[model samples]
Target: MKDLIFDNFQNAVDESLLRHKSILDIITKLQESEGRINRAVAKSVTNCGCIRVDAKKQELPKEDDDIEQLSNALKTHIEGKLCDSCREVIEHEIGNNLFYLTSLCNALDLNLYDIFIKEYDKINTLGRYTLR
Candidate 1:
């Protein structure tokens, strides 16, 4: 198989860590990075919601119409260049999500990576329990 490629924002964020000034720098950098990633996710969600509203605005009744509303909304958003409102929505949405996750991690004494690994191993190993 050909070499795999990652063309996503998350990949870019991960790759950026190598260029940091020092290992100590990574701690601060990581906090900033996660905030940014969560923000980006939020914006995309907001854009999707806006698209949905726009699609609903454009709806017309027809006999036996069975198309998914959100899918149609997405098409409308893309075609209409609905970015300004979507951008605001994304910023607010991402900010809130990032804030909550950061707060929860701080309060709960959780290591996201460790938790993720434990869950993933359980998923893969089906009834086999392993000591961490």
Candidate 2:
């Protein structure tokens, strides 16, 4: 059922994508979409003032601390949540990123769902060790 959704999205992208059909075009567009996402987030912080980023060097857990403690010690440095307008813009940009990502997979004759499953299986099998 989940695979069906991913397959349909890939098919939709393949069918609707007419201008940027070339692999090179798709790759560059994919890169552009990533930048757009970053810009949207930045706008939310700078323009909308809905969120604030207070990023700094991360402090590590004690040497004797467990993996769970390390996880708990980490921070995203983002305060508050995205407002509706900022959230919508970010979601749209991310969708564009996925479209090009699927296009790249299509051009390379790869199954997007299979790639997802492979990653999922690897993470599931590796658990916390997958971080490395």
Candidate 3:
């Protein structure tokens, strides 16, 4: 109903989170949401057969290769795109995950945007080393 802005969504989650106010509840719900997301993705590959995971050992680059080279050589192991049904299910599960994540941040008096910015800065600072 509202804009998908981070702070706005965080505030909305804070406002709507009436039942799971306790930190413990929020944490468990968050974990559950994560599990659901995993299940949804699994179903897409296993049941729906919309996508596939050709999971195998990552073909590591040469020892002397640059970080950029290593990054370029990496593979996600996921082949094929998610179908509309699978995408919708996964998106909904991820939305639930975000809801509880925002709830945890709210309970701890932390700003979701601040967390994002801090992580963004860390990644930017450690562009080459962050992989490790």
Candidate 4:
């Protein structure tokens, strides 16, 4: 099976949706994702056996720290299937993620699609990770 270049492809979803909408369309995708995520979450939890574990005691990072402990911790929990599948909620999260990626690209004067393509191509050619 072919590996997906964008493991979380939803981050770019909003860019496609906004192709025909005005600037205000940015908020549209965000709101849409929020709704979808909510629904998915609700469905997943309806009858699933899930566990919620609090992070072990640890000191908070200092202001100048570059770490994102919370995000990393949440991702670990999610991947561990601490909860069941929530399709509706996942959809919105995917869309909103794409929207943010697109926004970041625009801010940096870069093209997300092109960047992704180029990165993939480089990865394929090198057969391993290497700085571009």
Q: Which has the greatest TM-score?
A: 2
By the lDDT metric, which is better: model 1 or model 2? 2
lDDT per residue for candidate 1 within 1-132, as digits (tens), equals: 111221232233344434443544545555665667665544555645433223345554464654444334333333333367666655665654444443344335454445556778796896323322
In order, how many clashes per candidate?
Answer: 1, 0, 0, 8
Better of 1 and 4 by lDDT: 4
- Candidate 3 residue 18 Cα shift, in angstroms, is 1.2
lDDT tens digits by residue: candidate 4, 1-132: 122444334344434454634445555655666676665654554555353334455555566754455333333233225332444447657766566556545545566657877978888987523522
Give stretches of model 1 more than 4 Å off. Answer: 1-50, 53-82, 116-132
> What's model 3's overall lDDT?
0.92
User: Model 2, residue 130: displacement in angstroms?
Assistant: 1.1
- Candidate 4 displacement at residue 33 in angstroms: 9.3
**Which stretches in model 3 have alpha-carbon errors above 4 Å?**
1-4
lDDT of 4: 0.53
Over 1-132, each residue of candidate 3 has an lDDT whose tens digit, in order, gives: 222488788888998999999999999999999999999999999999999999888888999999888988888989999999999999999999999999999999998888888888999998879886
In candidate 4, list every pair of residues with a backbone clash. Answer: 11-97, 11-98, 12-98, 33-92, 36-88, 36-89, 37-89, 40-89
Candidate that would win on lDDT: 2
Root-mean-square deviation of candidate 3 = 2.5
lDDT for 15 in candidate 1 is 46
CA error at residue 93 for candidate 3, angstroms: 0.4
User: Cα lDDT of all candidates, in order?
Assistant: 0.47, 0.95, 0.92, 0.53
- Any runs in candidate 2 off by more than 4 Å, and if so which? none
